[model samples]
Target: MSHWLPASPCTPPGCAVHAGPARRPVPAAALLLAGCALTLAGVLCAPLALSLTGGARRERLVRCWAHAVLRVFGVGVRITGPPAVRGGAAGGRAGTPGVLVVANHVSWLDIPLVAAVCPGRMLAKSDIRRWPVLGPLAALGGTLFVERERLRSLPATVRSLASALHGGARVVVFPEGSTWCGRGPGGRFRPAAFQAAIDAGAAVQPLRIRYLGGPPDHRAPAGAAAFVGDDPLAASLWRVVRAAGLTAEIRVLAPIPAGAVPGRRELARLAQSTVASDSANLPAASVHH
Candidate 1:
């Protein structure tokens, strides 16, 4: 592994604890099957959806699908913060900038949860392009793949991201570069993605996601949904479905406008601090800006 590639120390044994009994194995199995069916549906319909729908309509479609997926897996969602700004709103306005959505990485569930609020082009590792089923679906959804291992490719990746934002496209990124166990602030927000926002003069929207209701012994209940270290995707999925009362609470912090801070490092710090605010209490959601 490249030294630059973000790695988390969280492992299933250390971080993930048994949240509860399966309750109903048959229901859990059915839900997992439904989730799979939905994913396959996306793969089959996405190309046509891309061709026929406008950005706004498509965003609504994606959001609804994401919500459905979460519901199927019995994960409830609670969102606190200002309502998400719809994408492509500034399409004809030359100077108006786009929004860059950033959040803490926890589980595969994070993907749909983020989409449930702000639908956009996701920044994913280049390896996702080779994954079965998901790879083609991601491409159809306009995901931007980054070659993180090759430091030489950073500039080109930034340029692509900038171009997308300049064209008034909302982009979602996990600035931590890896998933943590969701105990405290998992990892620092890397400054590279912030550079794209600065170059495009875009706004940054930071969201903090926490998983509620896990094993009482665990410090962070969010670990129940965490997919970190060597945790297999199948194991993570099974855990999420079997766990009882797993609610994903998303807190949307105030958005940092274009040119709010002088540099990417400062911009990244400001956003991370905003997301990390009130970590101890996990206080009520309120819009920061």
Candidate 2:
């Protein structure tokens, strides 16, 4: 929960576990903005192309751009688990057309991390849809917005997610409903999104995001990577940008088949338990650092 950024990078610089360098705030911020500009300019073509490209071309377009953004920002991603078997490297289908990637919400970086693996439609907070520039890009990519404050809108949002899955697009949802420090098992997995997977007969893939703490060679930091509470986006962004040596690990657990789980509530419980157990069993952050 502490927002202190590490001051040094671990030795043996090439190690993926090592967060390469100590970030210089001014340079990192400029770089972050540059990356955003590049991404926006590149993806701006998606809207026009979406209408003409009849295949996975549009997805690939946004995907390639996402990879570029993550690389420019110094975040690395690793995905582990069984393959989707049919769709692609990150897809897992249980006699269904698409995959419902359910991950624990941490910082906004989770988006590029996952996309660095493969492209997928994301379910974002309603406010994201109103952002100045990024909002339009997301709309072109078919992002679904959840009005967390409007209870009556839940059913419609779930239905939209189901439709996306049924249409063969990997749909990523952060069911925690908000961000947390991630030191403990994440907040409860709200069951609303589970219904989307169930209705679409899609396999549910549980993902865990662990923020790397400590200098690669020194002690792990006291708190885990999380962007929670009242931290402004600008502040969180600057913190990450300045922490050059900071890194996060993504673990993809076994996927749950469509029919294997009954009822939305039950599915939510199983998924939550699996993620919670994994987070609990993770070796203390200090040991790994």
Best by TM-score: 1
The ten-residue window of minimal lDDT in model 2 covers: 1-10
Off by over 4 Å in 1: 1-4, 87-95, 214-220, 283-289
Weakest 10 consecutive residues, lDDT, candidate 1? 280-289
**Model 2 score (lDDT):** 0.66
**Candidate 2 residues 1-289, lDDT tens each?**
1111111221111111223345666788887797677667755777677788644565566667776776676655446665432233233343346888888876777777666555678898788787666678777777888777667787898899888888777888888777655555556678888899889877788877776656666533223234665555565565666666566667778778887778988999998887887777655532223
**Cα-based TM-score, every candidate:** 0.90, 0.80
**Model 1 over residues 158-200: C-alpha lDDT tens digits?**
8988888888888999999988777765678989889999998
Q: What RMSD does each model have against the real structure?
A: 4.5, 7.4
- Model 2 spans > 4 angstroms off: 1-22, 48-61, 84-96, 217-225, 283-289
